[model samples]
Structures are given as structure tokens and as C-alpha cells.
Target: MIGILAAAALQADAPVEWTALQQDNIQVAELAYDVGIALAVICRDDQLMVAITGLPDPAPGAKFRKLEVNIPGAELQASTWRIQGKATISLAPAVYARRLRTADHLTVRAPAEEGEPARRYELALPSDHLALDQTLEACDVPLVLETDLTYDPTISAVTWATSPRITPPNRLPPGGYAEVVLECTVGARGRPENCRAIREQPANSGFARSALLSIRTGRLGLIDGGPPPVGGVFRTRLTINVVN
Candidate 1:
């Protein structure tokens, strides 16, 4: 029927473009390949996770704790808790992101033991990747006090009374993602002020503005234990990857 055909043409899912969401300052995006596999990039609370799911099961009696991964220009190892059907693997987010952003395909070899041959599978990497770019660009950093002491300047330092909640900027492209870095000065009570968006991948994408506004509404100060950090905290570099 023409009606059915028209409805199918407007399907919400697409292979080339990824879907994304934001919650509690966490960014998440996922894309699916035609070959029964899906990849997800989860950015949360200062950690990044890449999950590859819906993998073919290993042969019975085989065992593995890691997967051998091959993508354009690189060969590496991936850790996974599930080694059987629908296995999920975790690799270095930075390394995987670098490849995912540009590579056309990824090959994975399952570990085989006791003279068994390794099973191999290939995954197609989608190209329209804006959803992922924005997720990585989004940030949730806790501001701390600046000081100078021989040993413990932050004898009783503090941080945000409540953590900031951030979202993707309105100016991001439909399927284009971005990266942004910010350096914020702490004002009274550890409120972030004068935040300088030190970096933005696409230049004026609005990612920086969203992060700064959210930070201004919150406060930052010390670790929960009130103990000085082993190494003084001033700056940190957080890089990320995506699914868009």
C-alpha cells in the first residue's frame, strides 16, 4: 500500500546517523550496524565507556577474557565481561574514538583456546557521527579553590554544593558532534565564574556556552573527605569519542 510505503520511508532509525540523549550531565549515543551489532558510547561522571553488543556467540567450550581488535591503522586488545552470545567489549575510549570517527570498518577476532581457531567478525562504522561529537564536547567538571601552601594549601577546600547539570548546545549540527574544553575560575563558595571556553572543535558551536551556564548555577570546593588531594588540582585534560 502507498500509505505503508510512505510510513516506512520515515522510519526513526537510520544506519548512517546515530541517536543520542543527555541525562544528569551524562552523554550517551548509540548506532547500529546492519549485521546485528550495536555500539554505544557512554560518558558519565568523569569516565568513558564503549560497549559493543549483539556479537555472535563463541563456540561451545571456548573461553576468552579479551578480544583482538583490528581497525584501519591500528590493532589492539579489548576487554569484555561477556565472552559468549551478545558479548560487550570495552577498549580505551580515546583510542577507539579516534578510529570510530574515521574508519570504515572494524574487525574483531574472538580468542580461542586449546588449539581452536579464533572466530572473526567485521563491523561497519557509520559515517554521520554528530551525535557522538556533542556528547564528548559536553563536560561536567567540579571546580576547586586556587591556593599556595608549602604542603597543604587546601586545608579545608570545597566544591559545588550541588553538581551542575549540562546539555548539548543548540547550535550543534544534526549529525555533527563537537569537542570543547573550559577553564573556569572559582568565586566565593566555589561557584564557577569567568569560565573561559579554552577550546571548541567547530568554533562558536555553542557547546562552550551550555557548559559554562550550567557550571555558574552550581558550586564546587573539596573532596567529600575534606582531605587535600595527593597532588594539587588545578587543571585536567578530558578527551572523548562518539556515535553520531
Candidate 2:
């Protein structure tokens, strides 16, 4: 009983931050509640997060879990990573933000595992969407929160002047296939910068690591029609299929 009161007091005293704030080169916009839950967008990494404070550690060898996320009319499944008590989702950041922008509340359901009963949490969100907007803006992702994304970025006219070497992982199965989607920024001289994997197949396979290496040396070639505006988002998938 006393502990519950203490938690409530802590919640009341905590400062409210609804805008994207920078700390140590990483920018984030988040909404936290007294229930020990927070919805966050980590801009530098281009990932969404559901942070639950004081959550217990997972059993050994657990890599990920499917979390059910609920907004107005959609019930989405999130592949969540348990990191320091937070459920981090590393899929399409822009799409996630767009769906969340107009939501009045967010609900997360954690399915029961290993005999533990399932758990559910519902949280209210602000009507104003300044923070969410900032996240998309910071990454130069298109503004589609108000409407469906109709704009497809043009990379066709652009060529790779200095491109990274996409190679198959050394330990990959002889006849296996792997792919990774990278979110990168078009830096000076059309080179890709700050690239990170947003999706990967066969988790723990070295595909994601290799893909990053491939982008490390990639540079775009363009003229009148070109890659996304310098600093705009550039997403590309790297694939390796080794057939015997």
C-alpha cells in the first residue's frame, strides 16, 4: 500500500516532456504515465518504444516477443525486444508514428509465457502531436500523419557512384537467403550516413551486420532527378541468396 502511494507521488513530481528532447546526441519524443509506461520514439535509431519501468527480467535466452498494440481501430502486432525493461519495436518508424498521431489512447497487451498469465495496459495520449511530428521531422521522413503516404521517393535516376559491397554472411547456410532493410541519411556528396537496420530476416544471422558494411561505403550518383533531398530518408534492402 505504501509503495503504491510512493509511486503515485513520484509520478506527480516527474516533469512532463511532450516534445522531442536531445540528450547526448540522441533525440527522443515520449509520453509517460503514472502507470510506469511510456511511448517513445528514439529518433537517431529510427525506432519506437514502449518502456515499462521496473519490469522484471526475462528468462535466459529470450530474444524477442510479440506484443499486441492497440489504437482506435487497429490492433497491431509488435515484435518487441526486451531492453532494460522497455519493449523496443524496430519496424517502420514513420508508419508507426502516423498511426499513433491521432490516437486518444494506447493499449499494450503482453501474452502469457511459460505459464505466466497475460497482462494488459492502456494509456492515454495527448491530442496535440508536436512530439510525434518532431520525431518524423528530425529524420527527414515524410509527413504522413495527417493522411496516407502517397509519396514514393525517387531513387531510380540516382546511381551509386561509390557503393558498399553487399556480401553474404560467412556463416550463412550454404543455400540460405537473407535480407536486411537499412534506414540511412543522404549525407554530403550523396554518401549514405548513419545507416541502421530497421528489419532483418533470420535474427542473429550476420545479414544486418554485413548490410551496414555495404552502406558504409555507398555514395549516390544523381543529376536533375536524384536521391532523396540531402538529409532525407533513404531506405534500401540488401539481399543475399546463395543457391547450391
Candidate 3:
């Protein structure tokens, strides 16, 4: 029985103290709350609390606060890995205005009518938190941290890349080689929204462009709840035989 107890104690996960983000006298454009830099974040038994170094009155020009939390992925019962938590933040207009912008990019396109400044289509977060729990199971640790920043919905461009590839036409002269890279942007919906070729290789440009298009069409498995604030890319070199 003692062995079981010892093992249980060993198996118990320790709370993660993300001390790296602690700071002081910081200016918050979102919330009326003033926060100093030094911060003390404690997590234990599925509970979390953050104590900032300073809390001042809302600045005249400033309206809200951006509460930044870094969530870390962990190993569950067996091969299963997951992350779970709850965040109760103050989201008044003054406090949330700045925080929302911090969430993702808010673009303003030309309005349908003449007098309108523009139209806004804000990114949507998943309504299902349970789904988010499942998707995080297979994602890397960095992904969890990245997702936390996305919750605010005020973020802009989220980006990640893969390796490069090389493909050559079989009919090429004796000496022939090709290598190129394709970069793309994933929209808030967890799919490649845009793509661009970075390297210049005339022979492989066409092929690269096609491959980039394929990537743009591909979908990324996301937390069922919503799209993250950032995008991810898979880059690699490919060798395709050219038919001459």
C-alpha cells in the first residue's frame, strides 16, 4: 500500500509557475485597471491566481486591461495529453477594447455603401470548449501558449512555417537541381487563407505555386471550440520529376 501511495505522490503533477511573464509598472490600453510589472502566478490542483505588482486607476485615454495567460500542455492518465483551465477576466468595454485588438487583427474593408468607412468581420472563437480540450491533446506545447493569446479576439496575423522542397523536370540537361520554399497565412478558421513563394527558381516556380495552392486548400485540425489567433505552415523540399 505504501508503494501505491509513493507512486501516487510521484505521479501527481506539479503546478507550473510561469515566472517569465512577471513584470511591473506596465501600461494597459484595454482595461481601466492599472497593473505594475512584477507578477506572482500560482497554479495548484487545477486552480490559478495572478497577483500583479501594481494596480492603478484607469488612465484617461486608456480603457481596459489585457490579461495574458500562458497555458502549458501536459501528459494525462496514459498516452493521452491535454490542457484544461478556466479564466474569469474583467471584460468591460474600456477594459476589453485594447484586449480585443491584442487577440487578433481587425481588418476594415471598403463599405458596401458610399458613406460607410468600412465593414468588419471579426474572427469567431469556438463555442465548444470541450472540443478545444480534445484538440489540444495532440498539439505541441508551444501551441497551447499560442492559443491563450488568441482568446482575446483582437489579434491580427498568426503565422508558422515548414521546410523547403525541390522538384526538377526529368528532361533537364545533365546538371539540374531545384529547391524552393512556400509560405502561407492561415486564417482564423484554421485553414490556409493565403500563400506566397519565397525562393526564386524559374523552372520550379510553377510546381511550387501549385504545391502552395494545395497547402492553402488543406485544413488544420483545430480545437472544436474555435480558430486560434495564429496560423501554422508546413514547409519542405520536394523532388518532382519533370516530363519533357
Candidate 4:
């Protein structure tokens, strides 16, 4: 069964924190910031790659389809991996080590699907250069970049909804309970969409189904005049301890 997780606002100026996670044999160093934007550097199979999320689909027949980074006195372009809503660019480890050390911002300019003028998306470097340098070293990349300003996200408010009703399975033990975890993407309109269960205790338990149904029917509300929703992500946990 699916469940609703708590909703939290993502800050725009949030301090950049690099986190490393392993997927299969690949090592991914990622930083999420500025309203759904995720920047990641991946190392796998003797190759290095960079990816950025929150980009719109590219227009057909577009001639210039690549990512651009602004460094001191130079602009660099590389072949881009175009997906539905995000883009990635492959980089040699040596090249990445040099560019990431000096680049101030990464930008993407792509034509809108509806033929509108190209839009430019840019993300600034985090102020904590030392930490970023450390992260780069951990990834086996050299650190040559430095910055002095520190920034953190300006969070508005976090709101919660009433717990959903859970129907216990008939065959459960007298005091046994099940738990489910859900990940949801909250839309700009403050509605929970694209919710899915990520983990569940007790395989094949019916609690997951009940949790999803309740979330689909439940409403999540945000505070008035709060920072406009940034299409951020949130998680919720649901537990069913009572029997029908």
C-alpha cells in the first residue's frame, strides 16, 4: 500500500552539501538545491559524468544542444545527454578535476518545446569552497576552486495533515503492526502527486495499499503567503497497528 509522508519546503539559498551514495558499482556525489535542481558528478567504469535536473525538454531541430559552464575568462561547452526533463554531460576525470575547480556557475540554454525563445538556467557555486574541495578529493578529483560566501536555503514553513485511516488485515497477529514509507513530489500548487511506496515491513502486507488510498484522498495544505511551492520532494511514514 502507498502512504503519505510529511511535506517540507525546500529553501532556495540552502547551503550546498555534497552527499555520496552508491548505486551498483557507480559512485555518485550529489547536491540538491535551488528548487528541485540537482547537480551530480558520477564516477563509474573508469568514466566521469555530470548531470543536472529541473531542465525542460529540448525543442526539435535545435542546433545548439549542450551544457555551458561559465568560468573566469572562459565559457566551456560539452555534449549533453538529453532526456525528458533533465540533461547530462560526460566529462573526462582529468577535465572535470580542472573545470570543477574553477567554474563559478553552470548554465543551460535550450529552446522551449513550444518554440519560445531559449531560456537560460544557471546555478551558482556554493560558498563553502573548502567543503566542496574536500568532497572533490573524496571523489578522487583535485580541488582548485575557492569561495568565501556561505548560503543556506530560506525555508518558509513545514505543514502536516491528519493521519489517514488504516484498515488492518484480518490475518495479522493480535499485536503485530506494519509500517510503510512513501516518497512524494509536492507540486507547485501544494498537492501531493507521484507518490510511491519505497519500503514496507512484512512482505505482501495490505497496509501499503491502504496507505496509498488514504493519501490520494487526503489534502495537504501550505501556509498562506509562504514561500511559493518549489515542486520539492517530501517523505511520509505510515503504520498500521490495529486490526479490523
TM-scores of the models, in the order given = 0.42, 0.48, 0.23, 0.40
Tens-place lDDT per residue, model 2, 1-244, is 2222224323543444465667664566666566555566666655343233323334444544445665324554543434342343423456556656767766777777776777777766677778777766777776554423421222122347776787778799545988777788878888888889877777778999988987777777642233447887656667888887
Q: Which regions of candidate 2 deviate over 4 angstroms? A: 1-19, 45-57, 71-73, 76-87, 145-244
Which candidate achieves the best TM-score against the true structure?
A: 2
Best by lDDT: 2
For 164-243, candidate 3 gives per-residue lDDT tens digits of: 23333334433343434555555665565666756534454355555564555445443212243456543323334454
Model 1 misplacement above 4 A:
1-14, 57-64, 71-87, 113-118, 139-244
* lDDT, residue 137, model 3: 26
RMSD (CA, Å), candidate 3 to true, equals 18.7
lDDT of prediction 1:
0.53
Error of 3 at 225 (Å): 18
lDDT of prediction 4:
0.51
lDDT of 4 by residue, 28-59 (tens): 56566665466666666545556555555555
Flag the better candidate by lDDT, 2 or 3: 2
Model 3, global lDDT: 0.31
Candidate 3 ranges with C-alpha deviation above 4 Å: 1-179, 200-205, 221-244
lDDT of each: 0.53, 0.59, 0.31, 0.51
